[model samples]
Target: MRSSRRWRRLCGGRNSMDHTKQLLRISDIAAAAPDVLRYRFTAAEGELAPFLPGQYICLYYEIDGTTTGRPYSIASSPREAEEGGYYDLFIHVGGSFTSRWLGQHGTVGTTIRASHPLGEFCITPETPRKIVGISGGMSVTPLRSMVRSIVDSDTDREISLFCGWDDPAAMLFREEFTALARGCDRVRVRFALAQNPQPEDKHGYFTAEDILRETDAAEAAYYLCGPQAMYDTLHDGLTAGGVRPERYRREVPGELHCPPYPTAPGECYPLTIHTGSGTVTATAAAGESVLVALERAGVSPRAYCRSGSCGYCRSRLLSGEVWTDPDRAPATADGVFHPCCSFPRSALTVVLPE
Candidate 1:
């Protein structure tokens, strides 16, 4: 009886917590839409890692000699791990991870490694204004957790979710949004699809006009997560429609294809990178990304979010010509770089800061 009691206590208490943290196993992969698949991961012994709303986790994979790690937002609500013991994520296959993620089936017993829980995109008491979120396409991942938390916490503050996508078929978490809109009197959802529209739909890309027509623009704080094009479109549309810059709160995707603002005087150029130790120089061409050239020349720089979001490979430019993607960690006017995405714009020499 004593042993059983001890075992029960251990299993019901700290041991359960310990078990809740073993990486994860791909329990199920359900197809959400045409290109989207909901990859479900569960703890080995039916436990889950404790996580928070809006925080993301890292998915590790080895493609070649270099190990690539990608950070993905957990679309599932925090309650899943805090209350239950399963972690669910909605991933749409594309670009970088498309071939790998699609080829690997997330069936039961498939093992995968992931981080505890990470990210700064969440609700807080200090969020002075009522919630207002604007997302585009796959950007819905992080907001899904936030919206679910808002409803689950029973916060009386009003919220409006304005989401835009390419089309109806590409929309994610449709059922979840529907339930949220139906369940919370304080929650309102406005969905826009460029290709197709319902009778009361807002059409084409979301314009500043839509923001003005739908809700009070200035009174609320804004949260934006979306593709680069959507961001650029919204920036012009909002300013033209009178939405001040201060009201705009945005968290860029870990990777960006284009800049939201105007392109600078220089785009990309050839350069020679000088390593810090012995001053080894590697030839890299303009327009070709820094990381790409370095890898080609057999130089390895540590990086996680190959995109600018993770400052893993940020390097200082002793002196040279390089174009850095926007939203990178605070680089000096002297020129710092996240080599993973930095492209050379002039034949310059820089010491790889690692």
Candidate 2:
């Protein structure tokens, strides 16, 4: 664990204060759960820009001369962001980014570049007066932001949070949420434990029936965040129970488990890439994504939501074969491909639009 101050100082003199992105200092870091760390970040200079409570910010790092980025949800309230120009992020320590940098080389003075807040998960004036949130594991981060914002703003809106965890030890912000719920009559919190439930806790997962019984289900907007199985179960159940699709939204987790694609072991093929500058060649492994190969060769193509849901990294497939999940692929008449999710099946030549 060393501070990233040296790198930040080196780059801070450049256009580090660009409007779209800025450097943030790690003001504090604490363990929120056995496997999660809560990091508090503040602007390195001036004040951080305003953002909605449920929005996310993308963090970038230059690792071994290659650029990498990841988006994390803000868990702190909008009020806190306004007052101190700071926000909190709950990161799972097991991830490669956290293990390699935040957990190993991060310190209170460490500085990193972060994008302006960007996401559509926040509430708006057009939203319903009541919000019902369902979350599991680290997915609770954004929901926590909503709760804190509502409480801090003293808004008339109501919120009911239904959170599930393996046990008490894995629950995040338990004490803080308890205090908030106790002090604010507009807030209601419920916990469900899959194992070793306390007397006050629900014995198992919360079903649509469970949530509907506790809230004005017809009038409340639903926000869900969790694993794919949990989301599928609750989404189907809620929709079947008469909740309209327009009345609910879900956030994609950082790591998605896509179905296994065919792999060519011990084989690497030549990949020709055409950019505005000129044409270049790189080595692409059969099982690795085109984006991975590009980044390995120090090529940066605009990308966000690497799960294929976002089309930011879309490129032209001049000539090649790629395997991708049909459900996640965007329908296009032309040979447009998502480099982030598409794995090369044969030698490929692709065009990256400038």
On lDDT, the leading prediction is 2
Local distance difference test, per candidate? 0.65, 0.77
Residue 225, candidate 2: Cα error in Å is 0.5
Instruction: Give all TM-scores, in the order shown.
Output: 0.74, 0.89
lDDT string for model 2 (144-217, tens) is 99898778664578899999987778889777888999999999999899998888889989898898888776
Model 1 RMSD in Å is 7.6
Whole-model lDDT, model 2: 0.77
Q: lDDT score of model 1?
A: 0.65
Candidate 1, residues 1-354, lDDT tens digits: the string is 442332233233321222112468877788888767788777765456555556677665545554444567888776665565677787766555523554465567777666556444555444534677889888888888767766666445567888888878888876778788998887788888788777666776677677767766667667788876777777777666656676666765665434344455445444556675555566665545676666655554555455766455667676666677655554555566777767665566666663
For candidate 1, what is the TM-score?
Answer: 0.74
Candidate 1: residue pairs that collide? 56-118, 268-345, 269-286, 269-344, 269-345
RMSD of 2: 7.0
